[model samples]
Target: MTRLVSYDEAPPEVRRVFDDIKRTRGVPDVNNFWKALAIHPPTLERVWQNLKQVMAPGALDPLTKEMIYIAVSAAQGCEYCIASHTAAARAKGMTDAMYGELLAVIGMAAETNRLAQALRVPVDAAFRAAPPPPIPKA
Candidate 1:
């Protein structure tokens, strides 16, 4: 059985935000992460607000944003973040093919990034000064 903790044990402000979070986010109960973070309700609220604001629908569609999130989480090796964002990506309309390509690109980029770091590759002056290549006429 899960250990039950009384909200009275939590800080008064934490309890207020926890109640608000449950109501606003429509979760029947507080998630483990939030329960732990309830130790710092103000910080939790700030982080949640910032995340929600940035992730809301905008110039980038939700699925595309989710894909970006997944790629970053994968690069950082945050398994929890990867799982959450991948599920969000799928919910926002990612397909198997798209997910495959996304993973491939992320993997390739990660490999190249590691190689560059390992080799201590410096940006060449020639490449930095190079003009844009001419576009082929379609």
Candidate 2:
């Protein structure tokens, strides 16, 4: 909250990233998160690039990615991220019922995760294995 660089106040490099964000998202302005990051232009550019790439559709659909982001944000108790991604998910056609179910799942996971840690549960042999192989190329 200390430093917020608006588009008018941003350096050319920061403005470039802001432009991309607006253009890619089809919006008139970049959000406050980007404005905050614009204080550090290099990091702003890097994070923007990474976000664009990661949020692009590949294996997971865009809506699913947004929902995943919302879940992680909720787990981390980040109000900004939760609100932002929840808006995105709603824009992508998430129903009210889906939002309710997602919250329920998050609560259940938190309960189970804490219980497991408290009980010091050991990993089952059947569940221990090498990471699954990468998806085959088309």
Best by lDDT: 2
lDDT of 1: 0.80
- Candidate 1 residues lying further than 4 Å off, grouped into runs, are 1-31, 126-138
Model 2 worst lDDT window (10 residues)? 124-133
Pull out the clashing pairs in model 2.
none
| TM-score, structure 1 vs. true | 0.71
lDDT of 2 by residue, 16-73 (tens): 9999999999999998999998888889999999999999988899999999999999
lDDT values for all models: 0.80, 0.94
Clash pairs, model 1 backbone: none
Candidate 1 C-alpha error for residue 29, in Å = 4.8
Count residue pairs with overlapping backbones in model 2. 0
